[model samples]
Target: MAPTPDEQSRTRTLEGVLWMLGSGLSFVAVNGIVRHLGTELPAAQGAFIRFAFGVLFLLPMLVQLLRRGLPAGTLGLFGLRGAVHTAAVICWFYAMARIPVAEVTAIGYLNPVLVTLGAALFFGERLAFRRIAAILVALVGALIVLRPGLRDLAPGHLAQLGAAAFFAGSYLFARRLSDLAGAGAIVGMLSLSVTIGLLPFALLVWVPVGPVPLAWLALVAAFATLGHYCMTRAFASAPLAVTQPVTFLQLVWATLLGALVFSEGVDPFVLLGGAVIIGAISFITWRESVLRRQRSSAVIQNG
Candidate 1:
């Protein structure tokens, strides 16, 4: 007999939690690698190597795709997502080189809020009042973290902001493609496209580095591959609603890593701002969950 709905939901929730944890750790590891590389490697080179290695790591998935054949009508969407993701990777790598890991992670939380707004505006998803309020709150939190007027923001900060926006676009495209393509295809395309996209810049800025940089680059590939794998597993196990909040744990891990590994100090404003962002994200997650449950309940009732 098939499992009951409640049992299935519970199983999915547990799996999602595990996946989110893996995602968080993978991201932290990526950050660690970036920190380790520092200025030794150009950001573009780092981005290129990271994606190139990621493609190699995902070769098994590609083989499966070859066996199954590509999905119909998804290449365009995949290409769009890949392009946006390539932009995000470049910005994120640049920011990582210039900013503290914890700060970058904190600022990166803005992506979810942006995603919510994008879904509402472009996808015609209903924008609940609570979600709107949450977005505003999160924006304020971002401003606090940025402290725009009080201090000059670095070019890296702006790059990170741009990255967050582009990442939201990538997510939107991915969500659309999810209906037509397997996750493997999405990951494969992303890795391949980003590697290709970064090639020119990587070549232009190529530095003849020693083995240490190459080692760090390889580590970056490993971390990103694992992180994405864990993320894919999480989504497979549970709905996005359940898995989303678990991602916030990344900030905590990043903070610890930044402080201990890099000897980077966190500012009070960053903590306060991060708290606000977390609270807003939590609110958004809770609201979305409630909405999803209500819709499901209604559908069941009608059935």
Candidate 2:
């Protein structure tokens, strides 16, 4: 017998969760490797190399896209995304080199909330009261993590914040592009565009990197690409609400990895703040999902 609709939804959600888990692990590996690289390489050069390798890894897809050509109106969006994402990556690399992995990861949780707000502002999605509240709550969580009065906020913290905001912009662009292009095309274009965008900055900060670091960067490119692919699969498999909460595990993993591997002390404030931010993000996602279902039900009933 065929499975019920509810059962099918459950299966899809489970699959999404699993895919998100894989994405998180892939990112964890990427972060761990970047953390290990430390301040040995300039952030711009490091980001450029990673994305350059990303382009290499995506060569087949790029060639395929070149042969077929891109969809109309996608090139501009891809360029815009690349610009924002290049800034995000440089900031992230700088922060990763200077800060603890867990702190960087925790601070990055603000992206989803920012994305939600961006959707409302740019995509014309309704900004409900709950979303506004969630945004405020998430901001409070960010303050808790930073505790500006208690400790001097470092440049790394500021860089991570910029990275999160820039990343949110990049995500918004990707969401728009998703409607116009296939996943492979989107990913391939991103790698190519970011590599081009980063080229000038990398040239300005040119530094000789040994073969070992180059190899490690190639691995970073592979894992980061895999993470993006898995994340796309997860979104395709189920609603955002189903996969959003799973990201909380990334913080947990980052914390453990930081403590165990990097010998970084666990900061309770970061953990607490990360939890709070994740909770707000989860609430926003859940609310959106609920409203979406309600809208669908209303449409069906009216029909």
Compute each candidate's TM-score over C-alphas: 0.90, 0.94
Largest TM-score belongs to which candidate?
2
Clashing residue pair totals per candidate (backbone < 3 A): 0, 0
RMSD, each candidate, Å? 2.8, 1.7
Cα lDDT tens digits for candidate 2, 1-303: 999999999999999999999999999999999999999999999999999998888798799899999999888899999999999999999999999999999999999889988998999988878889999999999998999999998999999999999999999999999899998898888889999999999999999899999999999999988898899899999898889989989988999999999999999999999999999999988887898899999999999
- For candidate 2, the TM-score is 0.94
Mind sharing the TM-score for model 1? 0.90
Tell me the whole-model lDDT of each prediction, alpha carbons only. 0.86, 0.93
As for model 2, its CA RMSD to the true structure in angstroms is 1.7
